[model samples]
Target: MTCDEQTFTMKPGEFQALGTGEIAYVKPMTSDDLTTLFPQAPRMRPGLNLWVLLNADGTPIMLSDSRETALANAAEHQLHTVALH
Candidate 1:
């Protein structure tokens, strides 16, 4: 017996909007990366570790020094969190 496989595809925009406001991700970042990823963030000393919560489309939601806080923020917004790597 042989099994059949399913195929799926999406337009670039659709793919990027897959989760949209429904899902978010927590990313571990350094102060050095904040300027690029979250430009509005205030300047901070380099080498400090931080956690950032971002929307599915890579928009910054909030930044924190604790991953738990980031996740809590996601929960507060009713957004599901996705693990990276």
Candidate 2:
């Protein structure tokens, strides 16, 4: 079978079987890492009653008073947005 065929038939966690029994070290996720992996909603400045749009890197991009606008902004920017409750 070709690589493509193998890839298509492979199931989750099956890739571990191809390992050579070598110990793989992985770093624990830091707060910054978590922030980037998940979406964040920060309150806007006082008196605006809005939310600031933040990228995965936690950088402010835009501001909107509605959650839909924030999600739309993320979609327009080709980024995935998630709600953090």
Candidate 3:
């Protein structure tokens, strides 16, 4: 098989090649996008901070922050903190 076929054989969590974090074009994200974005959003509670991995439209791609905020955000299911470039 080709290189792609070989690489695809790896497990989900297994390390892959470069160019992994690539996405298509889209508009800026808004609060509306949050609903669909973070189905199980981690709510950032008081004294806690949640760092969001945002897309091109400012939508949170990943919902994981410091441990301090994890519990709070997870409990409340809050979608906050957009990652910086």
Candidate 4:
């Protein structure tokens, strides 16, 4: 450690709460992954590319064929998006 270096610690709960409502996650998905992550989604053709906007806690908010649409939806809901992987 150096004089200019600093460290901050947070409890597990606090860390998890960091982006409760203000942040969301954007994940790219294949049709195969859709059924598992979004059971409510309508059946679609196999091997389709898709994007999903999820809350900070991994709850699906919206699904779209276009990543832009997912991101736009997140912004519409006042959420900042982050890449999941």
Candidate 5:
């Protein structure tokens, strides 16, 4: 799938539509990432444990919890998506 298009385990992983084709995977903000992401928070949807995952090719694969298992799965699969929630 393209970066703008995704199929996330049939689950709802929201995609933040950034202008200039800079689409970001919407995920729950971590303390560190949050500080940085917050500046852009106004553009994000509120209140969801989201983590945008991508493929090696930079296509959105899914959003997931920030757990090792979830990350491992994504890494094993070599998904190009980022885990944002």
Candidate 6:
């Protein structure tokens, strides 16, 4: 029979067919797989005296006299911020 019309029967010691039509591309994933799929969180950098918000790539994105302002700037630009020591 053709693939589309094939009938599968599993015997007592046999392994059932796994990848059929829609499930042909399905596979199990590990923790690493999920991590790779999502990607690591962006890195945040603090200015020389904790006076600025830097991008993940270490580029200065905002400069403010206070930490709150810097965090606000990051928020306004839709960026996640983390405190860097």
Clashes of each: 0, 0, 4, 0, 19, 0
Instruction: Kindly report which residue pairs in candidate 2 clash with one another.
Output: none
Give the per-residue lDDT digits (tens) of candidate 5, residues 1-85: 6789977553223332222123223334433353243344333444545554444333444445564545665556653334343
Candidate 6's TM-score? 0.39
Per residue, candidate 3 scores C-alpha lDDT tens digits across 1-85 of 7666644465544433222334211223334344456767544344433344543343444544444343344334443332335
* Clash tally for model 2: 0
Per-residue lDDT over 5-60 for candidate 1, one digit per residue giving the tens place of the 0 to 100 score: 66779999999998989999999999989898876778899999999899999989
Local error of candidate 2 at 61, Å?
0.7
Query: Whose TM-score is higher: candidate 1's or candidate 3's?
Result: 1
For candidate 5, what is the TM-score?
0.31
Error of 2 at 55 (Å): 1.0
12-55: candidate 2 lDDT, tens digit per residue = 45654433232211122333333343356342233444445564
Give candidate 1's whole-model lDDT. 0.92
Whole-model lDDT values for every prediction: 0.92, 0.47, 0.41, 0.87, 0.43, 0.44
**What order do candidates take by TM-score, descending?**
1, 4, 2, 6, 5, 3
Clashing pairs in 6: none
Of 2 and 6, the candidate ahead on lDDT is: 2
Between 1 and 5, whose TM-score is larger? 1
Query: Residue by residue across 2-83, what tens digits does model 4's lDDT show?
Result: 9999999999888877887899988888998898988877888889999888888777888899999998999999999876
Q: Which regions of candidate 1 deviate over 4 angstroms?
A: 1-8
- Give the root-mean-square deviation of each candidate in angstroms: 2.3, 13.2, 11.7, 2.6, 13.8, 18.4
lDDT, candidate 6, 1-85, per-residue tens? 6778978777743343322111211122333333233355233342223354555544445444466776666667666655445
